[model samples]
Target: MRESKALQVLKGRHLRLEEPLLLSTVSGVASTKPALIRYFDQKISPIGIITTKSFQVTPNPGNREPVICETTKGNFGNSVGLRNPGMDQALAELRALRQEWKFRCLLNVSLSANSVEDFIMLVEVFSEVADILELNFSCPHAAEGYGASIGCSSEISSDYVRKIKEATKKSEVPLFVKLTPNVEDIGQVAKAVVDAGADGLVAINTVGPIVHEDPVSHTPILQNTIGGKGGCSGRWVHGKAVSCIKEIRMAVGDDVPLIGMGGVSTGEEAAEMVLCGADAVGIGSAFGTVSQKDWEPYLNSVLAEAEARLKPGKEYLGPKSETYLAEDRQMAYRKHTVTKIAYYGKDTIILTLDGSLPCKAGEFAFLWLPGIGEKPFSVAHNDPLTFVVKKRGPFTEALWLLSLGSDLYVRGIYGAQLENERTDKALLVAGGTGVAVLPALAQQLKEQGTEMTILVGTSESVAGKALLEDRLSGFGSFTCVADDGKNGRVLDLLNGLSLGPDQACYLVGPEIFMAIAAKKLILQGMEEEKIYLSMERMTLCGIGMCGECVCGDRLTCQWGSFMRYDYLKEHAPSMVGL
Candidate 1:
C-alpha cells in the first residue's frame, strides 16, 4: 500500500520502544503471572514490548490439564481458560513491574471481559500503568461470553469498541483490539472496530475452534466446555494471519497500526508481516520453540531478524544482528514401544518403553497416547525409558492397562538439571507415586561417589514392594514403608535422623509430606539450601507457554522440577506452609 516505514513509534499514549521494526508478545503465552513478567523484563531487551495474558476482572482458574498440546502438523491448540490472578493482584503486579523495569520496556496490558461496561472498567483501572491497553476480543477457546463472543460479530464488536474507546478517550490510552479469524467476514469485523475508533489492530488471534485428537485413541485434548475443541496457531495459520492482516489493512486504511502474527519464526516470515502492511509482528506459538533457558538469546535473534528484513521509507534495515539457528528446530516427540509393564496390584504399575531417552536426573518428560491424551510423568528410569504410573484418573488408568509392545509417544526431558554437587551424603525421600522421581536422582548421586540413603512411602495395598525395594537398593541405601507398615511410616525414619555436615536432601511426594519433612530436617539443623523438593504442577507444552507449571515466577518445566528449599520459601512460599 505504501513504502515501508520505521515501526519505532507504537503510539499508545507515548511509545518508548527502542527498535524500529516492532516486536510484541501475543497475550496468554509468555507474559503472565507477575513473577514471569519480571523474569522476562530482566531478560527481554528494552526494545521488546511486553504483553500480559488476558486478565479478567476476577481470577480465573483456567482449563484443566491437557489444556494445550501439539498437533501432528506441528501446530498448537490451547484452551488455557484465560487464567489470570484477578484484578487486585494484577494492579499490585503491574505497579511492581513499573518498579522492576522502570518503563525500560513498554507494557501492553491485555484485558478480557464479557461486557462493554466491564471492558471499559478494566481500561480505567489498568490504564494507570499500561502504555497500551490491548482489548482481547478474540480468544477462540475461552469460556462463553468472553473473547470470541465480542470479536466474531461486526455489530457486537463495533458497538463494544466504540463504547470502550469513548470511555478511554480521556485516559488517552491506545486501545488495540485483538481480532479473531473465526468470523465469516473478518474484514467486516475489522472495519467495524476501526470505524468505531480502535487505535490499533492485532489481526488473527487463532483459527478454528477445531478439535485435536489422539492419532489412534481419538481422545480429545483440550478441556474446554466445547468438547475439547481449540484454536490452532503456529506455522499452520501463518497464511491465514497474513491474509487477515492484509484484509484488515484494506478495510481500515493504510494509516492504522497492525500487528500481524502466526507462525512467525524467521526473518522472512517477519518480512511477510511487514509486507502485509503490519506495523508490528505478534509472536505467539513461536515462543514455544525455545526452552526457557534459551528465551533471551533466542528472542533477540528473532528480533534482529525482523529488524534486519524491514525497510523504513525506502531505507533497507540491513545487517541482522544475530542468526536464528534454532528456528528450524522444534520440541519434538519420539515413538517408543512399551516393552515391559509391571503391576503393583490394581492401583499402581510400571511401564517401560524400548530404547533410552537423553535426560538428566530431576528432568521430566511428557508421554502421549494417541486418541487418549498426553500427560507429564517424572522420568523413573531414563535408560529403557520407564515410568511408574499410579492410577490417579483416566490418563494414568490408560497407562496402567497398556499392553506390552504398544506404542508410546514421548517428548521433552524438559526442566532444570539438578546440579551434581558432591556432598558428604545424599538423602532421598519419596511418597506414593512420587517414588518415580528418585531412582534417576539416586543414579546421579551414586555416580557422583556421594553416599545415598532412600526412604519411600506408598499405599498399603501394594503388598509385594519388591520393585521399589530393588531399584533404590541398587544405589547403596533403601528403606520402604507403607501407610500401615510396622515401621511407623517413612516419617518415622526421619526422627532423630543423623545429620551430615554437607548432606543434600531431595524430597518428592505430596505437599504436606514435603512440608512436614522439610520442617523436620530444618529442626534437625539441616541447611535450607541443602534441602531440595520437587514441586509438581499440571505441565503442558513442556516449555513455559501453557502457564500451568509456574512455581512462583519460575516455570517448573524449565527452572526446576526440584528447587532448593530456601528459594521456594521466598518465591513459592505456598509450598513452605504446612
Candidate 2:
C-alpha cells in the first residue's frame, strides 16, 4: 500500500524549516501585481501558497464606489466587478514576481474567460511562470457567458478543463479547477472536472450573488449589483463550504487534490474542511478583517489552530503573543458626538466630533450613521476630530442636517503615515473639496521647517476666500484661484510660480484636475518623482479587503494615498495623464 498522491503535502521546495503547514491566500486579498509581488518580499507572509486574483482578457475598471459591505463577522457581500489588469499587464506583473520574489511559496495564477479557447490560450502562456493554474469557474456575480455560466454546467466545466489541461500538458503545471456551489450537484461537477484531467479542485467559490442593502435607505450599496445582488462570502458561507467539500471528496475519492474555502475564518473551520475532505484550506473574507501588518500572525494562528484541532487530546499551547486579527483596532468603530459644524458655504462645511482616531495626512476615515450608510472622508483636524465634508451624496447631505451633539460612529485612518519628503521648497495644490487632505499635509510640511506655498482652487464662488485663508494660510505663502474677471485660473497662477528639481509638490483634487496639475509640474522642470498625486478612489473598506479602493494597480488604502508621479506613470498612467 502506498500513500495517495492526493494526500501528498505541499512541502516547500527550498525552505528546510521543517514540515510547514499548507496554507494558501485566495485571490483578491493580495491580488494586484505590486501587492502580490511586494507583500512576499519581507517574508512577512507565512502562507505557502498565493493565488492571484482572476485576471481577464482585458482590463476591468470594476464597479463604482460602495462595492463592498461587511454583513457579519468574517463575512461580507461584495461586487468588485472582477477587477484586474487583464492578461498582458498581469503577465508583466508575474514576470516581475519572478525577478523579485525567490521565496519558498507556490505561485497560483487564476484565470477567467468566456470560452474554452481563451482558457486554453491563457494556459499555454501563463504556464511558463505558474506553479499552479486555477480556473475560476465559480465567481457568482461575473458578467454573462463567464464564471458561473461555465461552472454551473458539468459539461461546460469539463470541456473547459479538458482543453486547458491538454494545452498545458507539456508544461507540467498543476491544473486546479475552482467550482461553484450554486450548481445542482457539487459532486457531479467535481467528478466531471477531475475526469477531464484536473490535477486538483478548489471546492466552492462565493455562495450567492445575494443583495445586501442599507437598512434605512432601502437602497443598494454595491454599485454593480445586478438586480441588487452581489456575491456573498465569509461567515455566511462556512457551512456550505464544508458540505461542498464533503460532497466533492466523496465524488472524486481520495486521489485528487482539493482546496476547500468559503467563510473559513478559524482553525476549527480549517480542521473541519480537512476532515470533510480538503487537502488544503483557502482563506478569503477573513482577510477583510485583518490589517496588512497583522496578516502573517493571524494566518499563523489559524494554521496553528488547524493543526491543534487534529490532535485528539492536545494541550493548551498558551496565548499567542502575536496580536490576532480580531484584536486589531483597525476594525473597531468608536462612538463620538458631533460638537460643531462650520457652515463654510452650503456645499463645503467642517464637521467636528468630540473624539478621534489616529489619523495622518492623506489618510481617510469612515463615518457610519446608524440605519443610514457609511462613507469615507479625509480628516482635516484630528484633535476634537474634524472632517471637511463636501455635501455631495445622500451621506453628506445627512451630515449637513445632523443635529449637534448627535452620536455618530467612526473608524480608521486607513493609509500608512505620510513620510516627510524633505525639500528646500514645497508646493501644495488643492482643488474643490480635496482641500481636506491639505491641512494635515500643510501641518507636516510646516513641522519639517520646509518652505511651502499653498494653492487653492474652487469651482464655487471665491466669496468665502477669507474663511479658507484663515485656516490654511498659516503654513506658508497662500494663494487662492478665482477666475472672476479679477484673478485668472489656478493653472495661470501655477504658470507664474517658480518650479525646480529641489521642490516637491503634493496635489489632490478631481482626477482630471490632479492629472493635469501633475503634468504641468513635470513640464515646468520639476522631477516626475517629486510630484505626489492622491490615488484615493472607491475607498469603501478602510482595509484593502474589498478590492474597491484600487487606483490602477495599487490599493491606496494600504499603499498610501499619495504616490509619486514616476511610480504612477509606470504602474498607473491615468493618475498622470496628459
Candidate 3:
C-alpha cells in the first residue's frame, strides 16, 4: 500500500501516519497499557500519533465519580483530576509498549511539584521510551499550583520548558509543550515555550472548570461532592482552540509545529484547524463519541476533508465555522419525549420514547437529562425505542422520577449487537436489570426460528416479577429464578440443565455470575466460542474514547458489551472475575 500524505517531517523527524488525525491527550483512551495495545493491534485508523494520558511524578487519584458530564450544545465537562498511575508505573507500561508499538507515540508528562527537579525527573524517565515528549503544563483539573498554574505565566512556562529541554538533551526526543487556553494571553506562553527550546506545541487543553449540579438532590453531581470545576471539551472548546492556535501561530511566526486540538470531531474541523495554522490536528472527545470499529471511518472522513482542501488546485480559504457547527449539531444529541413509562417493580422501570432512532437488540443509547448527566442504557425494545432502567445511582434515580412527556436527550445505538446464529437450541440467562436486553434478543432469535430458553434471576419477590412474563411470553420458553425458594437461584436451575453440542449460551448479569456461568458451561462441554457474555463497566461515553468501559484490551462499548466467552478468556482474563 502507498504511504499516506499525512506524513510530515517535523524537526528532522519523519512522523509517519496514514492520517494527520492524532488521538489527542485523552488519558482514558491513550494512557493505559491495555488501551494502547488495543489501538496498535486493531489498527482501526492509521492515525499518525497517539499521546498517552498526562502523568505526574507520583500517582494522582484524581476526583471522585461522575467526573464527566455532558454540557449543553455538544460539550463535555470533566473533572477526572488528571488521575494517572505515577511515573514508575507509567514508564513500566511505556517500556513494554515501546517494544511493540508500530506507530509514533508521545508521552504527555506533567509535574506535580513547584520545584524544577520533579519536572526534570519526569522528563528523564519517560524520554528513554517515548517517541516524543509532550510537557503537559496545562491540565485544568490538576492539584493546586500544578498543570495550568505553570502554563498560565510565560516566565514559568519558559522556565519549566527550559529545564525539561536541558533534562532531555541527551535523548533529544522532540519536545512539545501543551499550552492551556485559560491563560490571559496564550500567545505569550506559546512564544516563551518556543523560544525556550520547545520543538512543537499542542494548543488549547480543555477550557473552564465547568460545574453541574443535580436539581432535585440540591448537591453537585460529581462524587467529589462539590466538584472542583474541570475543563470543557468536545464541540464547545473548538472555537477557543482555533483562536488560540491562530494567536499562537501569529506570535511564533510559523517555524514551530502546532498540533491543534479541542472539539475536533469531523474532517471539516480538522481542515479548519490546519487553516488556523496547525501542522497537525489532535482528536480527543470525538473518539469518545464513536466505537472502536468506527475509528477508521471517522478519522478517514477528517483526513479526506483535510486532503481535499490541501489539493494543488484548491484554494483553501478558512473553514466555515457556522456550517461545521450546524452539521455537528445534527449529530450531537436530539430531544426525545417520553410517551410511556411502566413500572416493572419498585425499582425498575421501562420507558418508551417517541423518538424513531434505529437501534439493535444489544446496542445501547445514552440518555441525557440536561442538568442531570448522561448514562448509557441498552435498548430494551426498538419499535418505539425503549430503555429499561434500574434505580442504581443518582442519574438513574433521577430518571426514575420523570413522568410521561418529559423531555430528554438521546444519542447513540452504539456497541456491537447480538448475532443471530443458526443453532438448534439457545440459552439466554440474565440477572437483575440485565433482563432488559433479553426481550429484544429473544425477539430477534424467535424471528430467526431459533429455539430459546430464557432464565431470569432476580432477588425481587414474585410481586416484583411484574409484566415480565407477559412481555417475554411469545419470545420463547421462560423461567424465573428468585433468590427465594418460590423459584430458585439461576445456578441451581442450571445445575440440572442439559446441553447438546448444538446448544449455544448467551449470558448477561453481574460479573461474578456470568463468569461462573461461563465456567459451568465450559465444564459441561459447551464450546467457549459458542457462549456470549454481555459486560458492563463504568461506561462514560458509550464509545471507546472515555476508557471507562475498557475491560483489558477490549473496549466494552466498542468491541462489546456482548463478548465471546473464549475471547474474554484469552484477552481479558481478569475481567472474567472467576
The TM-scores of all predictions, comma-separated, are 0.84, 0.74, 0.77
Candidate number of the best lDDT = 1
Residue 148's lDDT in candidate 2: 90
Candidate with best TM-score: 1
Which residue pairs show backbone clashes in model 3?
267-302
- Candidate 2 whole-model C-alpha lDDT, 0 to 1: 0.74
Q: For residues 316-409, could you state the per-residue lDDT of candidate 3 as single tens digits?
A: 3444323323233212466788998887767788888896766656677788775566688887777787787888888899898899999877
Clashing residue pairs in all predictions, respectively, total: 5, 0, 1
570, model 1: CA deviation in Å? 5.0
The worst-scoring run of ten residues by lDDT in candidate 2 lies at 10-19
Q: Compare candidates 2 and 3 on TM-score and give the better one.
A: 3
lDDT of 2 by residue, 339-403 (tens): 98776554777788897666778688888775456788888778878887788887788888888
Candidate 3 has an lDDT of 0.70
Cα RMSD of all models vs. native, in order, equals: 4.9, 6.4, 6.1
lDDT against true structure, model 1: 0.77
